[model samples]
Target: MDILYTIGAVLIFAPFIAFLLVVLIARKKMKYQSIGLAADLTTFLLFFSVPVSIKAIWEIDITALVYLIAILIAIVLLVIEWRQTKEIEILRYIRQTWRMYFVLLALAYSSIWAVGIVLSLLHFFRI
Candidate 1:
């Protein structure tokens, strides 16, 4: 039962994790290659799966903490990347694209949160 719950959580939150990694960390590379994007997305999914699974098993209230930490880390990384790679044109492009990325990420997060809430309500009502 625990394992199944873990898997479900992982399957739920995979895409948002992928978007975070590719947008925040890999955006500075010169290549902007497809392989890098795939790798980051894979890594994001893998890491995200584990934590979500653990949370499901433990019944943790991590909603605020997770978003807070993610937003803080994202801001820090963006500031650091901007400061360190000011001369790179790719970074400029990444900065421009980040707006779209955030919008998509917000939409994904909201959808996931809504689904989770609905599921929890259903479970509570024994539906």
Candidate 2:
């Protein structure tokens, strides 16, 4: 239980670190794609597990379900991207425009973490 929160908390930073690494050091390489993908998955799992822990200790919030669905969507997108293994039309275009993909994921994941921080603080202070 406590460990779940700890892992979840730690995982919350994974995506940010990955994003920063990609933007700062690996911006010129295709490796950013794998790093971003790993970060996104970590972010998804963090949210997914946190909600489960919260539910075990307290009543489940509506927002938990929303987060679960969002994680599922993220996972689906990752799978769709992964299944482009052969790099056909759309996949080839996506691979070619990897920068665009990284930018969008960065924006989305950063905003998610930002909102989570705000909401956590609000809840902590009972504001």
Worst 10 residues of 1 by lDDT: 42-51
Residue-level lDDT of model 2, residues 27-101, one tens digit each, is 466565656655445445444444444443355655556555555655566567668664546664444344444
Candidate 1 per-residue lDDT, tens place, 21-76, comes to 55566556734664456444554453454346436645665556655655665667
RMSD of 2: 7.8
Whole-model lDDT per candidate: 0.56, 0.54
Instruction: Give the lDDT of residue 90 in candidate 2.
Output: 64
For model 1, the superposed segments whose C-alpha errors exceed 4 Å read 1-35, 43-51, 86-127
Pairs in clash, predicted candidate 1 = none
Q: Compared to the true structure, candidate 1 yields what TM-score?
A: 0.36
Provide the TM-score for each candidate, comma-separated.
0.36, 0.36
Backbone clashes for every candidate come to: 0, 0
